[model samples]
Target: MRPNRVSLVMSWLAMLLMGLAGLFGACGVSAASAAEAPIELRQGTVTTTVDGVTRTEPVELSYHWDRQHNGRPGTASFDLPFTLEAEPETPWGIFIPRVGNVFEVQLNDALLQTYGDMKRNNDADYAKAPIYVPVPGKLLRKGDNLLQIRLHADTARLAGLSQVVVGPAASVRNELFESANAWRFTGSVLLMAFSLIVGGIALALWLTQLDVDANGMPRRVAIYFWAALAEFFWAVRMADGLVAEPPLSWGPWGVLMAACYAGWAAASMMFVYHLAGWANERRHRWVRWPVAGVVVGTVLFSALSLQRDEPAWFTAWLAVELVFVAAFVGAFALATLRHPNDDRLLMAGAALVTVAFAARDWLVVRLSDAYGETTWVRYSSVFFGAVLLLIVLRRFRAAAVQARGSVAALAERVAQRERELAATYAELEAAAQVQARTHERERILREMHDGVGSHISSAIRQLQSGQSSSGDLLRTLRDSLDQLKLQIDSIHLPPGDVGALLAAARYRLEPRLASSGIEFEWAVDEVEPVEGLDAHGMRQLQFLLFESISNVLRHAEATVLRFEAGMKGKTVQLRVIDNGKGFDTTRVMPRSLAERSGAIGARLTVESRPGRTVVQLEFD
Candidate 1:
């Protein structure tokens, strides 16, 4: 049992030792690989042989041979030693991180690769990215191989070289790809792509959200629209950093990048101002002119700089951009402090982040005199763009909620107004009914006064004077009662129908006419219905016809009475013809009765001579 326990302990010890050896072996291999990585020459000596005089000086990576250092346009050379573990026939490459103007690479005094042409392509400038030149296996020696580079810088604007690495093709390629600048450039490219996509979405939202206010002015979609424009321009500016060779010449490219920067600044200011609601303020008018002036000046200055070939304009433009950044950040900060809302806070934070990254880039360039293109500004811009997009989406959501509420409120108001209108209509109908009854009462009183009352007064006067016989008195009483009955019957006639009025009159007057030893004839043709004959007008018309017939029975001593009503063209003709001892119509027809006939859209005329009497009424 003791021996078995000892064997188990030994087995555990051996297993632990094996695990530790394996771990150490893995670490050793990793260290060896790291040590064998491509050599980056950060420090070098620049040698120039001009007019048989050679000059040498200690230089570092990204060293600028501008007017301050090496004034004249001449060729400068650099030499570095490279060691290889393998034999001569091994594939090797030299990777240049960055180069300005034109350059040539040489291995052991043999031409390897030439970049740019001084005489023909002076305007050609390389991007601050790696350029790989493969060294032929035959040209490369085993140890201490001399790699020489000759640089010709014609311009004072951004002429420099970053580090160069010499190693195997795979190692050099891997180092070049994994460089800090390459990572930054890749990040910028990714951010630009994201910004472009988000900008398109924001622009679509802005366009679809186009709405008008009550005053016929556009709503606040300008904020989102300008934010999208700013993001797009920022993406366009970043595209320059992603490429190894710009599409345009260096001068034109610089001008275009400056223009994009100016556009971004202008749009950013407009977006912030609109978002903060300052655009609706009266003071914005004054603020807008200065903003416009800054943008215009930026564009014009960039153009002039391109034409004059002045590098100082670039510095001025950068200063202007910094100022705009400061101003925007300050504005958003103030708005956040005043409003203290989630949106304002987010905008303020984004603004500060943008400014911080921009300042960091500017300081790095200014202090180091190197264009550190791998700044955090592009990432910060992407972050700001996301924030702005969120704000715009929130605004759209709020507007949608408000719109739904407005529709509900509007529906309620419409229902309330309909109820009010219906109640008002009902009240008006009741008032109209009352007014019609009042008018009818007045009409009845007038008929009684004109027809029945006058006949009764005549009968009373005849009896009191004893100038009338019993038969005459009885006939007057009977005629007065008949006139009263006819007046009451006219009241029951349907309004606006002259035929109904005439028929009613004949029914009432026929009995009286027969009692007076007179033959009555009613010749009423089927005439078209007449309009504009109201209740009062019909009563007046019936009374007039009854009075005419009564006159024939009481005074004219008519043997035959014929009442005729028919249409004559557009006019209604009403005729009461009597065969009786007629009076002089000129003396008998009253002026008041003629005037009343004219008031009722009718013409009245009486013709009486010897035994024939005719009372004619024509209505149009």
Candidate 2:
């Protein structure tokens, strides 16, 4: 949606366009015709005075000071004497459609109104406006009345007065107001405000996009720069005309006006050229000379106006600037006609209309015979500028919307990629779990081979050799059973829990050892788990302890068995002690126990004596 104020302005502009014709038509009914007893439209004589050489011209319907007194600042007067039956009512007025840079009106030698002070400094140019003045009935004698109009012109200004209409104040009031406002009192003010606000916004946005445009490219920033430059100075030019009292004197004010025009024209040409695809580097290089000439000419004109007394220098520079404007307008119209688009055609038409009006105004200023004509460009350009402003706003809004769409599309792509990554992570996690389960199965098989298989093999060997009775075979088979119990118990043991490991082996062997008349003493101190011990390492230690017990039973001929496990100062020691008539020390310590202790990074030792024997594992 458009901003609220912009929407309101567009709606009002549409309404204005729809009623423009009717509005002007109603205003066209002149007061000279509208009065009941209309004042006769008659010829009047104009006296021109220049360099103290007074010249009187023939009476006509209107007056124009010819080329003889043109460039010099001069005075001109129009005198109209008429006969009336009676004195008119108190509030009679006259409407003159156009005057000069400044003027004063008098009836019967009494001053009625003066539009400007003619103070010789900081005076405004009223040549572009129409004026109406009310009259005092006392000035209208019953038999004769004299209406004199006086005007002052600047060094280059045209001195002219239009045909006058005398009637009741109401008769001339509306028409005069309409004609004056036609010179763009309302239109220029509105256009100036619109251009300033819109141009400021455009320039600010261009600053943000210093090297890029709404399409995220580098091309369109130039377009925005040109648009803002043209509009800003156009508002300045409009302000020069709109203000009643300029900050500078008339000469400097006019010079500033031309400079503003030069700036606006150059910027407008570049703006249209870029839009129409005529802004290649080669064309810009060719056009640069003319644009530079305009700038140089403006500076030269300013210098000359201050240095010299002639008005011709100012006029020449201004005319050169107009030629530049005409060339650009021609190129724009030709391009639009050759390959028309909606935006190009609209701008082309506006260019043609505005330039045509400007040309008429230039003619009225240069031609001696042209009189009573207000400036046309003052009105036409403001209206065309409004249309142009609307076009720019539409394009800017569209670009903004497209940029937003691009950002949204990029965000959607990123979100899709994140979802894909999340799914991939889940698949990887599942694969890792399957690999871990397979490794655990292999570890379980290795432990069962070392513990249960070894026990059963020892039982089979004793039976084949016939070296033991049925009781010995029974104890050997039971040891194999205890290995199975330890394996089953290890499945639920926490990682590196040595205490639970020792407990499992003790529980299974206690009953059998007690039945064999061996007292079992279990001593378990508060022990910390070994650092870096893993599931596989715990299984090795479990089987090693079971093998130690077998050694005590089979070889030590032990009657008392003691198992001790705990942390001792900095070194942890676990031992199995038996009190018996011991066997050979070398034979009692199994090679398997030695290998298992080395696997768990502990040392294995065995000591055998007549009264006692010990199998011990030590950890540093």
Candidate 3:
């Protein structure tokens, strides 16, 4: 489970407890009724022993039983309807039970003892006696006196008391201590059982909603559920109050409680680690070290159970557990401080549990009687249940967020793939166009080879077959074939240096210019080396040039035609200028169309000027 899930669950439990606090108020009589509440307020006498001199003063006595007890008064060992006074040289002594729990004593209503010890009066059972203390003389005055005692009930006694007296007396009713014990057992049992039920419900929900195999929820949550169940059973046994045997003495309840607590501690840590995206093998080392120490301590403590009355052993265990709590709280604080967005829910849950458990445990240890009388245990359990609920809800939210991010990322990848596919299709279309042009040029080349070259070969053969006496028909055919071959060669030959190709064409055209009575002026620059043109491109340029010159020579009746060709940047520029009877450009449409379409007479045009026409070509 995610930490947020744990947080949400715990938060819910806390809210529920707050809602149900009224229920606990109806449980039973308050545990504090037996001792402290019986002491009535009264006036008192006191004597102060200062610098070896005795001085008298009047004092007052008053006491309030713990409020949770509904104001029931208790009986003191001494019958307290009477009042007596003692001086500084001789002060009153009072005996109050419910020690080993809590008490505050006063002489003549002046504060004297803050915390007093349990009367060594009980034989190991702690059920045998009441607490007793001697008040010092300095706290007394020589007059009518007042005395007060405030007691918090424990397992030994539930009534609180205070009085002014100077005698050893015992009360007839010993039911106060017995009642306190009974209340503690009942309260602990109910609280434990309720916690188990809550834990079980969470487990059932987790099994259904969480992907345990993929998310590791079963292992994470089962340990806590079972542990809590075991604790609940143990508490049930405790509630039965088996006076003849030790509580949790049989079966594996002790081991189970230890295991449950350990698992809870570990699960809490693991939940945060995974939720905040800091999961790693190394994190277990930090989490498990303290758990292991607890395991060892529990084992050792169990062995020492034969001497369970030793307060040191109990104190040591309590101290060790406190240390574990401290460590876990530190880790919780660190996680919250470092990653609030990711760990906020978890930290909130942990903090709730921490506060609830701490208050409950404090009362159990420091004021066991008060806690037993009050409803703290039930309240703590309810708070924990609500917190866990909050954690579950938040886990669902975080998972949804993660899912959305994954979906968005997947969509972006698909869109990019579609764009790549579209670009690939465009490249294929351009390649198809190039292929179609290649097929057309190949057909043209084939026709020239078969029709023109074959005809020329046939004429030569006819001349040879005619017995060396060729007629004019055969001779004329041979001459025509030669001219055709020359024209075809111009189209067939591979590309050459643009400068040289232009120079050769200019030289050949000069005679034609002379025949036409036109002067040819040529200007060609020293062109830089350039990539060659393909066969189709060469044929196109040659045809354009031939048509343009023919138009000037045949129709223009011009005196001069100027030709220029040169490399300009990456492009080759060519211009043909003629002094001719130029037609209007608008009226030259049919001729320009025929020339571009490769008809016999039409040629591409330049914009017409008053006296000259120019045609230009640019090649990349």
Candidate 4:
């Protein structure tokens, strides 16, 4: 838990940090008196000169400057004189693990190896890298051999060295510095690659959410955006260790690294705020002030790096960054404790462990080790990535469930509407059937009254007047029964059957015509059925025929009575013609016959000429 790491991790939480092996490089490490072990050059004289103040001290296997010159720019020379019995082997090497930022090695005044150019401010952080440089076999002598380590120091990097080991190539390369090399160089590359992949996918998913989904988490699952932003910035910040020849030089690259570091910090806080559902106006400003401070601090730190004389300005910057980091870490820890789930709680626990590591760095500051700002917190960045993924998946599952429910609800509504429509149709059909039955009943009553009732009234009138014979009264009653039979017989008749009425009337009243001494004949033609000539129209036709037959028997006094029916073009014509002592042809029409003819839209005409008369009806 470096202050920056625990804070928004503003210093770039997963920065390429000093190697773990560098922490214990000099502790209890020795080349014992064995034939195969290397020779340990522990005994040496160290000369330090800083700002014109020079001091010399006896050196040990591990050494550092006095605390007074810790952050000052200075130089140190480690003159290590070793006595060898003879040139032990050829093509040997020297292993000096965890030195200052830069240094060089010499054997008998001949420059043997260099870490890098110490005079320039390069992009790499050499304090993290272990030193294993080759020494020539020709430079070694039997006695009075000298090994020198010339070290350069800058701000924040104190004059220091671990033990020096002069041994065979295998001992120096494989035994001492191999594991340190793996952790510092190889591990940094792997972490950068892994973070880049994680960051890239997170970024893509965030972009997809931004482009498509509009609901779910507030601001459309914005936690993914923050998580992606944090991871992407961290990946590039980690590249500071592996990128030896960067695209930009030291000043611009440092500024870039600072921006990425501060950006990661702000994004992580934003992600946490959203995760806890605390991104309201109150807590939002809490994030904003710190972010503003980081922006200002980055600008100031960039300005400070440009000044060569202000080597201690870096310590000032780190001290101020410490204050910002402390406040951020406090707020972050509080929020983490108030997190919603076990996953976030796990992240908090990792931060706490990293805090313990950073606490060790604080307690042992005078120890002047390269584990100053370690990457212990970076070990748990996976927790953040995992939680972001979980939120995205959970939101997607919920959206799917809601969509399915909506479809099911819509289907149910459609089914309900269809059922209602079907019920309404059934009701309408039933109403139409009831109305038709009512109309049919009325039609039957009208037919009985007009035909049967008319005949019964005539029979009663003859009896009451006391002028009718028994045969005549009985004939009128029989005519009433015939009218009822005709009404029933016309029920099965189709529309526009012009001959049906004449044929039925002849069958019923033929006996009467014979009793009256009159013959009856029929002449009708087949006609096509017509629309609108329904059962009611047929009843009207029957009444007309009955009335006309009764007139021939009572008044015509004829020998023959003939009924004629045929189609005259599109019109249907029916004529009742009789030969007897006929009545006057030119006279007012009988109201009963005229009324029914008009009701059925039939034309009634009468013609009389001494011995013949005809009542004609035409229907179009």
Candidate 5:
């Protein structure tokens, strides 16, 4: 759903341009006679035309051998012999592609063109579609001239079909040149357009607010930028000389063209290297060396100011260029076979470049002699370039989408963590509030114990010393002082059951239980309010509970204890029963009663059984 508008538009434009290229390929005339040249003719097809040249006009020059002439596989000769009334001003030429069998062209019954062995299989590729060659302009005389062609279409070459056409040498030559021009110009335009679009998008991305920390660097976009620059220079050379006469100087022009191509190729290869997960350690380093060398060499050659033209140097450069392309292409093919990312569109685009470039170059070389306007080399390159451009654009878009998704996921995780932090902070604040209130209460209790308790003690001392008091009044004053002292010393606990505190105490005493051979168990079903308890009281109760558990373990040698906490009306019940030796509850009862007359005495009921004693305590 994260649509990058730049990538989207780039992808669409590249695709539309590529489609236009394909459509452009399908245009033009496919004539039956020699007037319309054969489209994409091969080796064997060339021989058929050679044989048909012997006969005059109205001759059946068709490759549909299966229809009539028996479907037998063998050499067949046909003729389209022409008789000249006067010497023609324009030179004439015929395009005879290699057919499946051996073929020879004869003018005035003289040998003109011959290819392949008579014994070779008709299934050979060279015989299928060879380049068109021009006939010598001097061959035509004032009188009649016979063109006899011989073709071995069966068992002589690969599946080859031939088309023979005769036209003015100048016109055919121009057409031959035009075909190359078509591919070059068209390819240049497409490449330039794509480069511009991709470059613009990459620049835009570079300018955008990117989540770099989480997403890593956008290396793919960077590669695309370099590729666009390379393609721009590449288009310049091809487009500049497209319609220019003399085809511009080949040396400087070739160097620039080669450099551009190498740059784009290297950039594309690097992009795939990273995109396909092959950009690791040794591989990346190894591939980059050759790419760099090629770019450097191309630039150097482009700048050299040598006036003398060396075709050999250019040819050698081309050979090296081809080798370089092959090396990267081989690596890419292997990568494609191993890749499981399912980026087939990209793979297909790269494959087309391989086939188109290889095929176009091959044809241009073979058909150098009989070159005409309707050549296939020119169209294929430009058209396929456009196709590949579009493919890369689509892949770029996909990468953008993946990046956006990762960003969104990271954002969600961050939000969740923020919420958790906020909740923790809230709990911390509440605990802090409770602590503040407890501190205030503790301060008040300390003041009362120091100030009020002193005054009461002084009053009791005065009364006992016979300072104007009746006996009943003196007794009442003494009881009031005792009550006031008790109240001041007592602590306030939080208004909550003691289950949580008891659980914590037990958790801490587990080690003691283990050493004393005691099994402790506890359960809390309900937690009632501590009606009069406050924070101070809760702290005092916790400390007392710990001290009692310690005494049972140390003095009574308790083996097993059961602690239960539950709600009983408005009071919280906390009980601990232990199996241990019995203690003298009556002896301590009197001392505890004498120590605290107004308060209930600490009560202990010890029941001794066969092997154990039980004692319990309860507080509200």
Candidate 6:
């Protein structure tokens, strides 16, 4: 399959899988209640040493102990008092919904379970969903049981505990399942998966739509490309919420997560601004610089946060993201109000939904002092991605419609051009026919001028000079008629064939030569035909031959005349020789014959001396 088609298929497949997961995830399967009784431990006492100062506090199981201590940073252990009616042989366990940093559960001063190393700077370990530790039945007393929890925490963060429960293994398992299925786990997984799939599709669409011009990529495509990158980074950052532990060290992971958040917000702002078509206006171009500055500032803050181990830098980054989100939402809303189009409206709705969820999560994180509880924001990304998909689909549909219209227009143009060409061809054909008729008439007139008219004029001149008698005049007229007949006969010879023209000339001239008491010798060699010997060229050649024979018969006083036509390579050679008392060639050759032979690309020569005379014509 083509790359675009493959990308489209995979995108659809991912969407289908997401839909299926959402469907299955929302449907809860009820399991039987735990086999043993359950108890909620709501009272405990927390003691700790900070800067070599000892402190003690009484805490409730349902409250965050970190708040009771004025949010101070320290290592502490919580001692809880509980009672067991009987030391049952069945397994008993404790379930804590959440914990801060590293902690260990001890049953009656015996280590039951340890989570995370207290010495390691594993801050993210506190963000885990729930902790379940199995209490050995042998360690459980028949009357009173003590459970201790040791925790390590950082400053300005929540540490200690939230609601703790003690029950049989089955009850603890059920509670753990319930905690894991909380909105944070399922929602983050869904959002991350959806973001990845949509990001892939968006990037693919951006690649396919990339238009390169002299000025580089168009601003609109660039905006969409950046939007895709933002979604991809958002997906990567959300992956941290899906896992129980950090994939990398806290410092690097913190930097990466911060950068991703900053990048996502910045790119989203740009995408919305451009999508609203405001980016095209000169006045709005300046807005992008400040937004870019904010993004760069956030990135630098993230790096500083990592280097200095300061959470304030990260908090500032979050504030920047919130400002970006607010601006993006406001811009989209204003665009929707101005344009009131379906696309703009959809984008506005998506932005509003995302911002609303983000605000709610922000409030929850601040009030509850928990990171894992703010999952609605991730879920909101689905709406945003859907809107982007719709936008791309609409663009594709519009392009397809425009393409079909262009093809139809091109076909109409081609048909109109064909009609015009047909009309032009008809006009050229008529013009050619008129020209052919004109040329034929001119050819007939020329033949009359050279044969009959010249002969008559010669006769009149002779008569006016009184150079010949009536009988001689009659003979000259008869010879003129014969010449006219020869001209007519030459016209009927096949074109481009030297031998046929030679035979026609001989046929016409033989009787006249024989009547003059001369023997006609006709010799023609079988040779390849010469091309481009048209009727006009043949007529000129025949006229030259006939004129030569006539001159020999009338004035040479010769009895034998020989005419030979043959091929010399690619040239045609014709020679007429007479054994007669010849005259000087320079005086006997006619200017008209020389000019006609030259016009037809033929070489004409006459050699006459003593009792021999020769006329030669060669044509290529």
Best-first order by TM-score: 1, 6, 2, 4, 5, 3
What local lDDT does model 2 show for residue 371?
A: 75
Across 1-620, the per-residue lDDT of candidate 3 in tens digits comes to 69999999999999899767755543322322222122333444433232244445454432222322322222221112333332323233554433222445656556666553333211122221343455665554434554544333321122333333333222212344334444554455565566566556546545654334555554443333433343344334333322322244322343444444444544554544454444445655566566556656765653353233233343457566666666666666666676675335545565556655655564554344332223343345445445554565566566558768877998999999989988998898899889988986775666556445565676677677775445443533543443354355565455645565566567566775675578989887776533555554454455556557766765676899998878778666778888888877775643543444343222343666667887876555
RMSD values, in order shown: 8.6, 16.2, 26.3, 18.6, 27.4, 16.4
On lDDT, the stronger of 3 and 5 is: 5
What is candidate 4's lDDT per residue for 1-620, written digit by digit as tens?
Answer: 57755765644533424343544443323222233357888888889889888899887767654344655667789899987665555467888766766778888999987766777654344556677888776777766888998877655433477778887788689877797778767777776777677667667666665323335434445666777788787777777766655677555666677677667666766766666656654746566676667657765775575445343454456456556655665666787666546546655554455445544444455244433233544444545445555654565566568768977999999999999989998998899899889877777787677667878989989989999999889878878887788888888776776666566677777877887788878677776565566777777767777877777776767899887778789887788888878776556456778887888888888888878888898887
Score each candidate by Cα lDDT.
Answer: 0.74, 0.74, 0.50, 0.69, 0.51, 0.73
Q: Is candidate 2 or candidate 4 better by lDDT?
A: 2
Where is the poorest 10-residue window by lDDT in model 2? 29-38
lDDT, candidate 2, 412-509, per-residue tens: 99999889988998898898899888877876676667667876888889889987789888887888788888888878777677887788877778
Instruction: Please report how far candidate 6 places residue 484 from its true position, in Å.
Output: 12
lDDT of 6 by residue, 1-620 (tens): 69999999999999999999877765522111222467778788878866567778887765453444444456788888887656655787787777776777888999987777787664556544566777776887767888888887654344567767788877676656465656556667777888788788778777776444457755336655866887888898778766656777665666677678767767777878777877768878987887787667777876775565455555656666677668768877976897798888888888888888877765665345443343576767878878877776686577568768977999999999999999999999999999988997888788878777887888998799997888667757766887787778876877767788777767777777787789988787975565767788878777777677767766888999987888888888888899999987666667777887886788888788977888888877
Per-candidate TM-scores read 0.62, 0.59, 0.33, 0.54, 0.40, 0.61
lDDT accuracy of residue 158 in candidate 3: 25
> How much is 167 displaced in model 3, in angstroms?
22
Model 2, TM vs. native:
0.59
Task: Please tell me which model should have the higher lDDT, number 2 or number 6.
Answer: 2
Q: For residue 440, give model 1's deviation from the true position in Å.
A: 4.2
Model 6 TM-score relative to the real fold? 0.61
In model 6, the clashing pairs are none
List, residue by residue over 1-620, the lDDT tens digit for candidate 1.
99999999999999999999999999977765654556776666788654456789876666655433432345678776666554433466777766766788888899898877745433566545457888787776545667778876543345566677876677776656457545666767887888798789778888787677769988657777887898899889878766545677665676777788778777877878887888778876576776776677877777676566454565566677688669867977987798898888888898888888888876665334563245677778877888988987898888889988988999999999999999998999999999988977876777677677877888999999998998888888887888788777766788767788778777777777777789988888876655787776776677677667767777887789997888899888989999888887656675655766776778888888987888898877
**Candidate 1 vs candidate 3, lDDT winner:** 1
